[model samples]
Target: MASYKLYYFDGRGAAELARLVFKQAGVDFEDIRYTGEEWPQHKSEMPLGAMPVLEMDGRKICQSLAIARYLAKEFGLFGSNNMEAFLIDELFEIFAEIMNSHLVKIYYEKDEDKKAEIAETFKKDSAAKYLNLIEKRLKENTSGSGFYVGSEVTVGDLLLYNSMYGHRKWLGKFGVDVYEGRPLLEEHFKLVGALPNIKKWAEERPETAF
Candidate 1:
């Protein structure tokens, strides 16, 4: 029952991982959003001048992954042991890096041609370097439950699901589908997306161009 406020642009971006965790944990938090026009005015107030800062009991924290890790610990979503937590973080960072690779280009590149080119390369590189590795990793999880870390859903799972869901929704414009063709990833994506809390949040959460 701590006072929590999450600030982000009006979209399902970085803050969404924590938001989904909150929903899964069944916690109430203020989801403060800003628009492009309003962001600059309040930009100076954000820690690191970045959005997706999580303020808990008036203490502000920045960086999406850090906030996510903290929340995972807070909500018992980190995993049951140190080893579990390690696996969870490992999977989370891998998924985060993959998502960020394309996200930076999609958000910052001004040239449509360049962006398209980047997307093509991203699709190719991701498949070659990551998609198979992740499938093999998922196959190694003891649960064999299509989860990234353990038997129960963890923060890593949410991050993975969010990456795929967002990629499918946001990256399709560039003709890139990060979650395509990998059978285990597809099943993992489906399993996490269909979780009760996540499904509900997806149904009701604000729509964003991202």
Candidate 2:
């Protein structure tokens, strides 16, 4: 059993998926959270000047997706085979693209009108397009068991779950509801949230604005 320490801001923003993976795998790790004021003091110590960083036995790993991939492979969440791994990677990339393009703007934009415009576009366009595709993928899987790859829950499922959870929780403040008219996606969200480990982790997790 390797020792793990995760460094991230006091919010779920990008670190939540990795946390979910750890919980699902029954792994123990030190979750080090920082506030905005505390982050600058610790930022210089991070390898990439950003988080969420995963320290394994003192070796630092930067980037959220990279950490998620490492945990996935280490804990048997990658998939059952090579093709499944590839599919999971592809799905993860797609989710990242969506987050970068639409979701992130709402957080950084200062102008109220511009932020509103971006949020609406995200809800009407990006969320609709990508989430429906994800829903179709879930429905097409062998077991239709709500896992993203093969018949088991892969890192892809965790990624999608976190993305949807963020959109609902964070974007909901802007009156953006991505699940509107998407029954499959709504059901998928509920299913992921209902998983025993994830549900327990979520219940006990610290609250943050993001």
Candidate 3:
């Protein structure tokens, strides 16, 4: 077994995908978290002066997306070929864009009322727009099979899993159920969640709030 250690803040913001991947792969690894105070001293030691670093075989890797892709490829979660992997990567990139847009207010917004306003606008415009597009893609990808991107589970599925679930909470806070109008999306979420390995991983891990 490889020596795998994932370093991050004690939240689901960036490292969740990697964690889920490791869990679903039934890999035993160390999960290390740090607080704001501890990060400054630790930051200088990191390769990129950042959190969410994954130390594989004692070699440190940086960047959440890069780490995710590396692990996906390592664990066979990435698609089988270059083109298929590229397609999975493309969808993952799209999810990253959506998360980056809304995460600004999540960590920095201080004013209660203004933050609520921002969340509401984000939900209606950015989040809704992406979900609608994803719903259409999901409907089209349903060529007698339910999975997205390919016939088998891929990195794209995990990326979409995080985005859809993350935004659902952000949307609900604004009185909008993110899945309200998207039955296909709901089914998609359920299918991802019901992946036997993923469901077992989720259940065994301590309940984590994003």
Candidate 4:
């Protein structure tokens, strides 16, 4: 087996979803965390000048979603079929949009007035636009109670786990009940969160706002 090393800051940011996938897959990898003071010295060495980078036996891959997707495929977590893989990948893409368009937008907006405006409507905007779409997808799934893609957990589920559960506090800051009015979403979150590996990892993982 090849060695894996994941480099990211010492927080449950982009890297956490990959970590959750690793936990679910029972794959062992080196988690290389960097502090704020330590990042600058190594930033120039990164493939895209950012993390979280996954190095497989020294060959590196950048971007957290890519890394997680690769690992999930290797670990039989992407899906059992090509169409399933597409569904899973598309779900993950939706989350990337939510993270970039709404979640991160609130924090990165330098103008306080704009930031306040974003916070005021963040929950409704995000729910109506993104969460509603996800809810519809959930309704399409078998029973609307199982994992997003198939009978088991997928990389997409990990991304969903991260977006809402991992960052629940941040969303809650704006009174975003991501699970509200979306019973399927709530059940899925609860089911995924209760998976043995995920539950154990969540119980023992470090506490972080995001």
Candidate No. with top TM-score: 2
lDDT score for residue 15 of model 3: 88
Q: Which stretches of model 1 miss by more than 4 angstroms?
A: 99-103
Determine which window of 10 residues in candidate 3 has minimal summed lDDT: 170-179
Residue-level lDDT of model 3, residues 55-169, one tens digit each, is: 8787899998888888888888887677667767767767777667774765477776776787767767777777777776667664445777667877678777777776676
Q: After superposition, how far is residue 153 of candidate 2 from its true place, in Å?
A: 1.6
User: Candidate 4, residue 71: CA error in Å?
Assistant: 0.8
Q: What lDDT is reached at residue 129 by model 4?
A: 76
Q: Model 1 over residues 146-181: C-alpha lDDT tens digits? A: 778778888888887887787777778877776777
Question: All candidates' lDDT scores?
Answer: 0.83, 0.85, 0.76, 0.81
Weakest 10 consecutive residues, lDDT, candidate 2? 124-133
Clashing pairs in 2: none
Question: Where's the lowest-lDDT run of ten residues in candidate 4?
Answer: 170-179
Error of 4 at 132 (Å): 2.1
Superior candidate under TM-score, 1 versus 4: 1
Once fitted onto the true fold, the runs of candidate 3 whose alpha carbons sit more than 4 angstroms away are none
Task: Give lDDT for model 4.
Answer: 0.81
Model 4 C-alpha lDDT per residue in residues 1-210, reported as the tens digit of each score: 788988998888889989998999988888899888999999988999999998988798998888888889889898888888998888887877777777688788888667667766766555577777787777777844478876777887887877777556665665556556777777888888999999999999878655
Give every collision pair in model 4: none
Q: Superposing all C-alpha atoms, what RMSD in Å does each candidate have to the true structure?
A: 1.6, 1.4, 2.2, 1.9
Prediction 3 global C-alpha lDDT: 0.76
Residue-level lDDT for 206 in candidate 4: 78
Which parts of model 2 have CA positions greater than 4 angstroms off? Answer: none
- In Å, residue 59's CA in model 3 sits off its true spot by 1.1
